[model samples]
Target chain A: MKAKKSGGNSLFSVTAILLILLVWQIVCSAGLVSPYLLPSPVDVVKAFISDLPLLIQNARITLIEAFVGLGLGIVIGFVFAMMMDRFEPLYKAFYPLIVLTQTIPTVAIAPLLVLWFGYEMTPKVLLIILATFFPIAVSMLDGFRSADRDTIRLLESMGASGWQIFRHVKFPGALPQFFASLRISVSYAIVTAVVAEWLGGFGGLGVYMTRVRKSFSFDKMFAVIFLISALSLLLMKLVEVIQKACMPWTKTQ
Target chain B: MADLSIRDVSFSYGETQILKDVSLHLKDQELVSLLGESGGGKTTLFHVIAGVLRPDRGQVLLNGQDITGESGHVSYMLQKDLLLPYRTIIDNVCLPLLLAGMKKKEARAKAAPNFADFGLAGTELQYPHQLSGGMRQRAALLRTYMFSLSREGSPVAALLDEPFSALDTLTRQEMHRWYLGMMEKIRLSTLFITHDIDEAILLSDRICLLTGRPGTISEEIVIERPKSKRDGFAVTEEFLEYKKRILKGLKRT
Candidate 1:
């Protein structure tokens, strides 16, 4: 029953999207909107097909930067969360700082990162890490802190060591939240990489979008925008797949 | 077999005293229930006995050894089953053994045989969410039993804090039956915490009434019946008498 309900919802979502596309195509065909400003769905599709090879090449670069940055972000975030959870003093001192990092806009940070690390892949990766790590760290820390006190006491009663308590209880308890944050961080990683690339980069989807915008080829720019959305959605889906694998018990529920 | 004793234990959370001069004992293979109202420090006493909290005064002893302010001497079970969502039933039950430094393969081998005894034979490969409420409680009980196993293979005492309180009435009654049967077979000394008068009378060899602002054992009542004879005991005149006495004692407090 639940699965069927979700399936119906997805069908409605697809239909809604298609209806909007049809209206867009009609408006562009009637010359009500300039193609340069608002390309029709058909024109965007055509542009996507024509620029497929170049898009793939640039996407590969962006994906590499995103993946590398996201991986590093996860490691750093895990460490930060562990430290915060294990030590009260550290948690008190660093929790606000961690939250502060999220207040700064990614766009604002991208330029500074580019200036510091130059137009190379370094700046793009750094920007992605900066954007990605906050959610992972914060969510994981919350997860750890939210572990049931009774359960912790239960383990402690069994002569479990500090490390044992962490391994058997805290780590597993944090996984669901970790995956939740990873979904957010994954999209942040890709978007941040692209944003960083826009400022300066040898090659990436962002750099390509910048070039297309300068040439006034809005159709190509629309295609890149759609592609980025698709990529972010794909990464989020991958996170869900991994979450299922890691937490099979959730599936049974 | 092992016995547990909490002697003159007093605990406070800063200025707020939770327990005052709380002392209790569980003989080998005996079941003792701590009966009280909410905020009566039943849980605080359990925490002290479990060694998760240090008493401002007095000692917690297991088998005549002082275990005050120390953990890992007794097995503790909480209201929630607290099965790790990411692990299989076998793995979850084997947690204590793993924490004790046993190899994973060896721990699994040891725990596998007892799954049948615990009425969890086929659930070895399943996760906690796949089980019913009653089944999950049984698994948690089995895990608690596993935690109580000494290096030499003797079972220690267990501290259970409202282990079946969350279940529905039917399941709770069923759990009561199952618990009595398991206790007969294993002969584990247990200190159970609960506010339910009928449950205290049904399961305990002795019931300790904990009451007042700074909680202390206000009274102790002994039930005169063999374990096997206690089936359907809730409807008996003797059960009613005990319940009336307990209710009067609680009301007095």
Candidate 2:
């Protein structure tokens, strides 16, 4: 029954998307919008099919950067969360600073990163990490804090060590929130990599995008945008799959 | 196998005293209930007994040895089942063994046999969310029991705080019967807390009335009826007499 309901919802979503595409195509065909600025859906598709090879090549580079950075971000986030949970003073001292880091615009920091590390993959990966880690760390910390007090007390009564308590309770308890943050961080990772590449880079989807925009190949630009969105959606879907595998209890209900 | 005594334990969170001069005892293989209303510090006393929280005064003794502010001496079960959502039922029950540094395969082997005794044999591979409320509680009880098992072939005492209050009326009654049977077989010493007078009368060998602003043991009533005769005893005149006495004790406080 649940599957059927979700299937119906997805059908509606697909219909709505198709309707918007039809309207866009009509507008472009009637010359209501300049093709140079807003290419029709058909034009974008043509551009996509023609430049598929190039797009795939650039996408691979961006994906590599995104994956590497996101993996590191998750590790860093998990460590930070564990430390904050274990030490009261560290939680009090660094929680505000962690929040503050999120407020600094990734765009503003991207240039500095590029300047420091040059136009290499390091700056791009760093930017992605900076963009990705906050959500993972904050959400995981919240998950850890929200663990049932009674449950912790129970473990303590059993004479569980601090590490045992964390391994059995806090880490497992934080999983749902960790996955939630991972979904957000996954998209942030891809987008941040692209943004970083725009400033200066030899390869990647963002670099490709800049080149296309400069040449006024708007259709190609639109195609790349669609590709980026598709990639983000795919990554989010992967996260969901992994989440289901990790938390089978959630599926029983 | 275990004897637990809380001696004149007083606890306060700053100026707000939660417990004052609280003393209770559970003889080996005995079941004692701390009966009280909400905000009467039943839980506060449990925390002190569990050694998660230090009492401002007095000590917690197990087997005549001081264990005040020391954890892992007893098994503590809270109202919520608190089974880890990410783990299977067997794994959840094996947590204490794992925390005690038992090997994973050995822990599984140890916990496997007890599943059938707890009415959870087929549920070993299932997740917590897949089980009924009663089953989850049973699993939690089994987990608590595992925690109480000592290397000397003697089990430690268990501290249960309203362990079945979350279930529906029918399920709670079923659990009560099952719990009584299990207690007889296991011979575990227990310090249980409950607000329900009938529950205390039905399950406990003795009931300690904890009441007042800063909770104290107002009365200790021993149920003289044999364990075998307690089936359907809740509706008996003897049960009513005990209930009336407890109610009067609460009122006096």
Q: Count clashes in each candidate, considering only residues at least 3 apart in sequence or on different chains.
A: 1, 2
List model 2 lDDT by residue over B96-197, tens digit each: 888888898999998998999999989999988889999999999999888876334655898899999999999999999999999999888999899999
User: For residues A74-183, could you state the per-residue lDDT of candidate 2 as single tens digits?
Assistant: 98988899899989999999999998999999999999999999998999988888888899999999999998876776776777777877877888888989999999
Q: Alpha-carbon error at B135 in model 2, in Å?
A: 2.3
Listed in order, the DockQ scores are 0.69, 0.70
TM-score per candidate = 0.90, 0.91
lDDT of each: 0.89, 0.90
- Runs with alpha carbons beyond 4 Å of true place in candidate 2: A31-38, B13-22, B150-154, B211-215
Chain B TM-scores across candidates: 0.97, 0.97
Candidate 1 chain A, poorest ten consecutive residues by summed lDDT: A150-159
- Residue B170's C-alpha lDDT in candidate 1? 93
